[model samples]
Target: MIRVTAALSRARAGLMLALQAGLAAGLAWFVAHDLFGRPMPFFAPIAAVIALGSSVGQRLRRTTELVIGVAAGIGLGDGIILLIGAGPVQIGVIVLLAVLLATAAGGGAALIVQSASSAVLVATLTSTTGQPWTRFLDAIVGGGIALVVMTVLLPLNPLTVVRRAADPALRAFTGGLHDAARGLADADAGEVRAAVERLRAAEGTFAAFSAAIDAARENVAFAPARWRARGALAQYVDGAAQLTYALRNVRVLLRRAETALNDREPIPGVLPVSVRHLGDAVELLRQEWDRGVEPLAARERALRAVAESGRAYREGVGYSGGVVVAQTRTAVADLLRATGVEYAEATRRVRQAIGWTARPHKARRRSGRPGSMPS
Candidate 1:
């Protein structure tokens, strides 16, 4: 069933790509005929293919850069053309000026390629005629056609991508957090490790979502609200990272508990509440991430629960049991406290950094040392 679903998804994606390609080709043809006053030769097809294959977001950015670069190149080229005279020397000066201008604009390899292509276009179409502006306008028209086609036909909307990606990523994060919390509660080392790994993978998915948003921003036709949502989603990624780290520490503590149990002694009364609170926190984070909104009271309640669990664990280990068990409990309690503190700080930092309202509660402050109960 899963394999069939996967196959269907791939097929749909392929269909979308085909549609986008066809749209780009049709638009490129129209623009070629309208601007050049005749059917375009091979270059129109080539340009359409390039535009279709290129990332819509990246192509838009490159177009803007190219426009700026071309304008600068023309200004310099014209100056050089005037200084030298209309001859082999003039053409040579134009090429030199194009390269220099492109380099100054921080055009790497792609810019160099664009510069060479633009230089050729100027030389063949507009050189010695004393009008670089006309050729510049032509390049803009070509680029504008490409941008418009991309925006209007089968658009690769970043909001849609981010929204689609956020659902699964949030599920993974929440599910992983739940699993880790259960593992911590039950003192199950393997489950905790697996959950943490899944959470780490979810972080990568969020990164991809962020990249997609960046691409979408370059499309002039895209909605401003979509851009704002993307920015909001980017802020949420930092929160997710902090949650992942806290969960990872919980896994480590679970491992320590496992080791102590194997030694025929385990920490007394340490697992249950810790896991429950952690799970609650994970769920809250997942909700916020998916919806791009958070309830401060709910988040604060979850944090308090986790902190309480850490406190309980610390209290349970205060007495010396067997040397091995006592030391193990102490270590686990320290880990839990550290993880809880880190999680709290991460949530607070995310709120402050993003200008979100801070929860109206007393700030949590951990004792300077590990053995003390978390406050």
Candidate 2:
């Protein structure tokens, strides 16, 4: 069922890409040929299609690279074909020259491939038209229109893109947090191990989240249409990274929990409540991420959860139990950072939320090191 859903999602995304590429190409061709009276102007649509690309993110950089590649191809192809005339040898030479020149010019894979392709067209077709600058003009027309269309015609919502990737990841993380809480409550060794495995499984979700944010960053980087949301989108990207860190901490906490459960150590009652509250907090965080609005009520709830757990800590249990609470505190603190809180403040807030009445936590609380967590 999951596979089917994933397949359908991919298909939908593919359709969107195809539609956008078709629109951009057709528009480029029309403007270059019909509007400008350029002879056929085939390169224009080709440039537009290449610039549009198929990926969901970073159209700006891709468009820029494509434009550079097309320009290089047209210039190299026109000059070489004009000097040497069209032939198999001239074709090969122009392509080689275009690729080498593009490479030396610091072009990436897309630029290199585009350069070679454009060189071939210029070498073979430009001579037929008897106008060297026509295709160069065609290339310019295609690239500019592609950028304009990509930027404004069907502009992507950065927040929507972030949510499409972040929601699943956040849910997975929330589930992991819930499982870890349940394991602590029941002191079930098997359940703790299972939760750990589930957390590991969530890595893919976070990876997709990271990729989506990167795309959003590119989309918002320069386009005036997307610039207004740039700050919010950037926050989402940073928040995703912080969530990754929180998940990592959750994994560590769960492993410690599993060991504690296996060893017949005490499990605090408040720990489960705290963990469950944090689970809810993650959901709220999702909401906050989606809206790009943060009063950080989610972080507040998470901090409160830590405070509740600290209540259990005040009474004292075993060393393992203390470590568990400490880990939970730190994990919640990590999550709070995702809410746009500073690390120092987040740590202070987590400690305050836990309502730890005791003195400062010593280095020997869990692992015997100075402020560094055990890996």
Top-scoring candidate (lDDT): 2
lDDT by residue (tens digit), candidate 1, 14-103: 565567667766665666667565433334443454445554335466655554454444445545555654566666777776877678
Each prediction's RMSD to truth: 9.3, 4.8
Let me know the TM-score candidate 2 reaches against the reference structure.
0.74
Q: Report every candidate's CA lDDT.
A: 0.50, 0.77
What value of lDDT does candidate 1 attain over all alpha carbons? 0.50
Backbone clash pairs in model 1 (N, Cα, C under 3 Å; residues 3+ apart or in different chains), count: 0
Model 2, which residues run further than 4 Å from truth?
1-23, 73-102, 116-129, 133-136, 152-154, 182-194, 197-204, 207-211, 214-221, 226-238, 261-266, 269-273, 291-297, 311-321, 357-375
Worst 10 residues of 1 by lDDT: 319-328
Q: What is the lDDT of residue 138 in candidate 2?
A: 83
- For candidate 2, lDDT tens digit of each residue in 249-271? 77877787788778887777887
